[model samples]
Target: MSKEICFIADSSGGLPREILERHQIKEVPFYFKFQNTDYYCENVDYTGSEFYRHMEKNPEDVPQTAAPNVNDWLGALEERYVRGAKNFIVTTISSRLSSSFQTASLAKDVFAEQHDDVQVEVIDSNTCACGQASLEIAIAQMIESGKAFREIVDRVNQAVGSVTTLFVVNNLKYMEAGGRIGGATAFLGKLAQIKPVCEFIDGAVRPVKAVIGRKNSLKTMMDLAISRVSDWSRLIVTVQNAEFSEDADYAVDYLRKAASYSGKIYRSDLGVVVGAHSGPGAAGIGLVEASPLLR
Candidate 1:
């Protein structure tokens, strides 16, 4: 008998509508709050570019984001289950970065209790935005290829270690407001025009290097990403931007010239959830090895 697997991810994944519709993937939106007004990330009311436009006008008002409600996850799971999905593979942003993973896990438990015949697995992507999206895409493909649940889970776990995410923000103020950097550090960095290159370390975003300009910051980020990949021929890259399409385009061009990857390079918006904290002019690259390295 064939298994019906349902794929779900949070809005933080930054997956495009085509992928969602094509793969039948369900997304739970995160909540964005600006000046006491709440906006849903998945809703049509606010888009990533619109959110950045609002921020440009109210530079002082920092937007905040909240994970999807537990009920949202439960609803998604139950709805799909009722539609004849016997297995569920849910992916979310890093557990260290947000509570969505915990929320999804809880929802999975509740869903399993109500439907004892179903199997639900919640994957902590250990990264956000394009990183999560890449994993979701890979998982969906595996499921379509008739991979078993245990095999799919193992592949995802291996992909976690093989993926590398790097990004740079134009303004440190957003990072400071989000508590990713200290006020003093943000102040000093701004004074010196220092741009920090951030990377995911053990599921948490951390500033790994600092450069003098945006140009250098992008170069540093790309270099750091390239250094980690043992073989560029087996690489899948995702370039994400927060209202910085020009820069993202340039980065993609540069990556094409610099790397030897034979896989597809996905371009995506940073999404409102991460864009709220990264602010405008933020660009990132997520690299995933197509084949897992032997341990």
Candidate 2:
């Protein structure tokens, strides 16, 4: 029999459903409710387009997501275990951002007690949405290439630290709506058209810098990317958001002009799971590869 290692990820992994299905990866999606109709991310019950349309019609219908229960996680692992998957690696959003990491870790420890021979490694990722998903995809690719479990795990840890996401919101409306912006700053930002640059630092979203104009916001992000990147040729840029394709394109253009980009540029849907927090006009560029985190 061939060596079997399975990858299990939560909805926040940000990988497109088709790619996950193509690779046969297991996904335990989070829950969202719309107009009393329940939806699960990456589930057949609800789709990306449908979720966005629902949000458009009902902006007050803020979709909330909850982490999968321990049983839910155990069920996914057991299904793979029966199929001869002796080892499993589960990637989840950051513990600081969500309890999913904690939930997955507890499930791993509990499941390990029942099956001593099986090893389940849970990664916090210290990221959310596609940023978390990109790390999971990297692990899946390495496993598919026949890399050893230990080697894959080590590389994953390194990549987690290396991955960085920079978000530039078109307006502070969403942040204000989400109560992330304070009364003082929100008022000032709105009046001045000041775009705040937020990033995933360590495990949480923190305001790193601010720019006066959209152009500067884009430039600031690109400048940060260029400064952090060493070998530009190996860099892979993943741009994500529902309504900011133009911003994504502009970021890619800046990178092309400033650095070496050998890897392909992938644009992914920010989806409702993240849109709820970042808002509709938010655009972000996530830079990832096996390297050190740029300070």
Candidate 2 on 78-119: residue-level lDDT in tens? 998988888888888888877888888888988899998997
Query: TM-score for model 2?
Result: 0.87
lDDT of 1 by residue, 9-81 (tens): 8888888677787888888888888886856555456777788888888899998888987899999998887
The lDDT per prediction is 0.82, 0.74
The local distance difference test score of model 2 is 0.74
User: Which regions of candidate 1 are displaced past 4 Å?
Assistant: 1-3, 293-295
- Judged by whole-model lDDT over C-alpha atoms, candidate 1 comes out at 0.82
Best by TM-score: 1
